[model samples]
Target: MPKKYLFYISQNYSFAILRPLQAEIQRRGGDVKWYLEPNVNASYLATDEEQLTTVEAVQVFNPFAVFVPGNVVPSFIPGIKVTVFHGFDAGKLDWKGKNTHFRVRGCFDLHCSYGKDMTKQFDALAETYKTFKVVDTGWPALDPLFTTDTALNPYISNKDNRPTVLFCSTFSPRFSCAPHIFDAIKKLSESGKWRWLVQFHPKMGADIVNKYKQLESENLTFIETDNVIPLLKSADVMLCDTSSVLLMFLLQRKPVVTFKGNQQGEHLINVSSPEQIESALIDALKQPDELMQHIDDYIKYIHAYTDGNSSARVLDAVDNFTFDSLKTKPLNLLRQLKLRKKLGYWKLS
Candidate 1:
């Protein structure tokens, strides 16, 4: 008999995208599981949130197989555990260090990204563990954004009747210069050329939050919600920093402008100057067809899945895992424990 598995999904942008797929999986008589945070109320289905420890989580679910996207809590479980990383956020502080994702994965997903730099990171990860399969599934999160009934996304109907530019940036001191990414957008705002949808990350500091709150621009509207893809579509241009939103905008093949900072690390990718920002924004505002062509050539290495059928392909790869297929070695266990200790997630009791 095919194994009845526990599909463990966690909190993040991807869960909203994959929630609808549960019915698709359930029709085949497979059980799916998820963890819901305190804030979200999933009235229709049940999810387990007790994600404090790995062994505890495994014991709680207690299914034939375990499934989870790349989350901090899923690192401790034993047996056939599949991990799917949407991007490189866990180790963004020191991205150059060895990719920790190889330690425990029937699969690790890095397919959400579409930048040239992101492809290089995955290539390095591929060199680390030949055991973990890295698959490019166009972000499963984008799937829902594209498919959800228009009623699910009411922003379009309620949108202000001005052409809008979404300015999205990640929250990090490193990306401090990113707030200025909208300087050009403000120029457009002044001329009543377009409206601006300014979004703040969940991690933004109070100081940064207050700055936006005090802003006197009527042309700008602030957005704080999980589903931002509709806003992405409604915008004429997207001004972004190093956040994954840039990748999503790229999927739209829209023009994205980064900052011209000094140090080019993970969060802050240094561009040339304001001229480049204006140039990129102008290109995005003008030639979307040309930008789509750039996305075709740019996505070759970064995100492998172009079509919206990523979830179907991923399940196919998971189906290939025969019972008792992947063997466990003693050294592998020790390496995992040692790595966890370094990450401070283990007590070794």
Candidate 2:
């Protein structure tokens, strides 16, 4: 019989991250069933072939392996719980938040690291728990960024002569650069020399979302979607804060201006405050070629593989866990029950 896998999508943004892996698994003669969060919109099921399953489906299907993008998974669920991770940023400070660059909660049976730095970290954490396999499979979500056709990106436009600027921000009220750089962005948008595209984290506050939505003008466009690979492909320069999206932009070997970011490395124009926005933008747009070396070095550090085959590697890890079942670890019952209740998975029972 063909193998069966379960993909747990907790949010809309997860589609961008998990779809590549799901498609690859199906190509390899495996079946994929999506178990979605209750809040996920029906519109996300864009295909007749794509059916939304539930926690009860997971229980009955007994998939060979379960892939999760978010950190937590129900401990009681059968099959190996595989963590694919969300982003590559290590964060600006020790914020103790959910997407804290890198973290390990003993909920997963296997931990797939995107690069060497993360592999070592997960290895150390696994030693402490003695309950998971740490494998260095590059993040599958980024596969599109490497192999995408630019023409498919809806946000691209050739209507103007101005350089395209993508302004992306995290949703965190404390760490986000949105609130701090609004005035500077407004001035730049009014100049008409640069085209601005604004995209934010899904969790960004309603007031802030509304505030930027109102900023849409001739030179400025507000994009509301989870898929950013297209925007990354289309922009000349990126303006961001401490969000992991900066890493995504950097992967293009393009110039990026960051406001108060936590981690520092090559090719990033780090500004202390919003006042430096104009100068930074000028420098980045004028000499983006000069920053390629730095961007290349950072990309090598975070992701060891750039061959557009990370989806294959991730699925190989899944196959390893499923076929042998020897590498799999049993779930921590107490932790499983606690998370099930905390994340509303218990409601399904």
Best candidate according to TM-score: 2
- List the candidate 1 regions with Cα displacement exceeding 4 Å: 1-11, 20-23, 36-60, 71-79, 88-130, 149-152, 157-161, 181-191, 216-218, 261-280, 288-292, 304-306, 322-349
CA lDDT for candidate 1: 0.53
TM-score of each: 0.69, 0.91
- Give lDDT per model, in order: 0.53, 0.80
Model 1: residue 141 alpha-carbon error in angstroms: 1.5
Q: Please give the clash total of every predicted structure, in order.
A: 1, 1
Give lDDT: candidate 1, residue 84: 49
What local lDDT score does residue 193 receive in model 1, on the 0 to 100 scale? 64
